[model samples]
Target: MPPIHLLDLSFQETAEAIAAFVVETDEGPVLVETGPHSTWPHLEGALHKLGYRPEDVRQVLLTHIHLDHAGAAWAFAKKGAVIHVHPVGAPHLAHPDKLLHSARRIYQDQMDTLWGQMEPIAESQLHTPADGEEIEIGGVVFRALYTPGHATHHIAWQVGADVFTGDVGGVRIPGGVVMPPCPPPDIHIEHWLESIARIKQAGAERLWLTHFGPVDEPVPHLDALAARLLDWANWMRPWFESGTPPEEVTPRFQQYVQEQLRSEGITDPQVLQRYELANPAWMSVWGLMRYWKKKLARG
Candidate 1:
């Protein structure tokens, strides 16, 4: 098996906020999750530290096309790397104007600082793999499993017994507690739970989370994540039913998560702030609220 190296992007100057995995094979290096373009320089520096150049990447794989996960993918594509992604995300990557515009609505003035520039990947360089498709780049074989709920375009790549779970595995900052990154527009509790089950069914011995690093205890980690996901969704269900505005619920949710962190022994304000930045309470409120609304409509 080709060795997999975890490269820390140091998002927002915080360690382990986001990560990109490099799989070294005989052909060249294959990168998974480019992170936001804002941290491209850091990624380049990390590659250099590992004795590689940007042009050394021959293939780039994305678990999803969310800006944080794939914003800098075009950079690799520009270096002549073949970009592999779910079909649902292929078009947006090929023509990122819509994606950037949607993100702008969320980031506003912080756009450039948060995500940097998202270049469009030319059609020729884009490869959209099927749900169960296995992609062999160099000597490594990655099985793409469509794991939506974090986002409709999400996919979790499985390599041997290790799965590169994007947001499907939730966000865990080092010693901090794990939390669901339920950002808006694509949060579906049922889908998320089902995806978690799929990951479990894959029988992965380790899970490589894009939010941070590899988790050796896959079962318990996934179980805890599933529970927290349902717990957070249930917690927000009533807020939505009460017709509470997001702004009002955001702070309450923030406090609630902070309290949970405290119970888990994470009390440092700075560490708490890092969790907030990684998986904001406001975003969770919006996403979970949307899920409940859609659930009501479906019923």
Candidate 2:
């Protein structure tokens, strides 16, 4: 462990958003995620404050291709940093057409304001990680754990006991409770639970979450995450089962989540914003409903 220093570059005071890591490696400084584009200046400042230049970054490992995690990767790739990401996400980075179009639809006018610019990464700087492959950067070996519930291309980087669990381990609000961010289309409840089980079995010393910081009380937090995962599904499953539209289910799920946050003692508006950034409750509820609909249609 090189004592990875966390950079709250995203400035996520209003929402539970992304956190970038500056890992000091023998090779140089490596970045785990590069928040969104709007936060680039802050990220750059943070790097300088840490006694490093932006060019000091030699490797950038991304958990997935989501805009929040790998969106700003081009900023570093342009500076000669090699990007390591899951194979499923490699193509998207090379040509971000579909990714950008989809995001534009979701974020609408706020897309560019929030995410900044999403540039395509050159093929030379892109490295698709294989499961179980060990990447030794600056002498620290990180084993890529393919934990794909949050996203089909998600992976958790395991170095020693600290697993950089992107969004697989669930979102932990500031007050200490964990909840599932079930965004639509790919939010498979079964697969997500299996991934959680995998993390629990890994016996990690601490889980480094991208939304915020690390947590060591593994069992309790994992339990809360697991229960919430199921509870979210159970709460919304009935609505979809009754032929309720996704748009209709969204508010119900949001209420369910908001109530859960209140129960956990997170009463502040700022804290609520943070949780939203971690896992947009509406998007997740739609994802679960989409999965449910697809499964039922197939059956």
TM per prediction: 0.98, 0.95
- Can you write out model 1's per-residue Cα lDDT over 18-93, one digit (the tens) per residue? 8999988778888999999999999999999889999999889999998889999999999899999989999999
lDDT of each: 0.90, 0.82
Off by over 4 Å in 2: 11-16
Best by TM-score: 1
List pairs with backbone clashes in candidate 1. none
What is the clash count for each candidate, in the order shown? Answer: 0, 11
Per-residue lDDT tens digits of candidate 2, residues 1-299?
Answer: 78788887655434336788877888888889888878888888889999998888889989888877788898889988999999899998889988889989988998887787988899999998788899998789888989877788999988888888888887776564787777755777778888888888888889888877788877787788888888877787788899887778777777888888888777888778788777787788788888788778878
lDDT: worst 10-residue window of model 1: 269-278
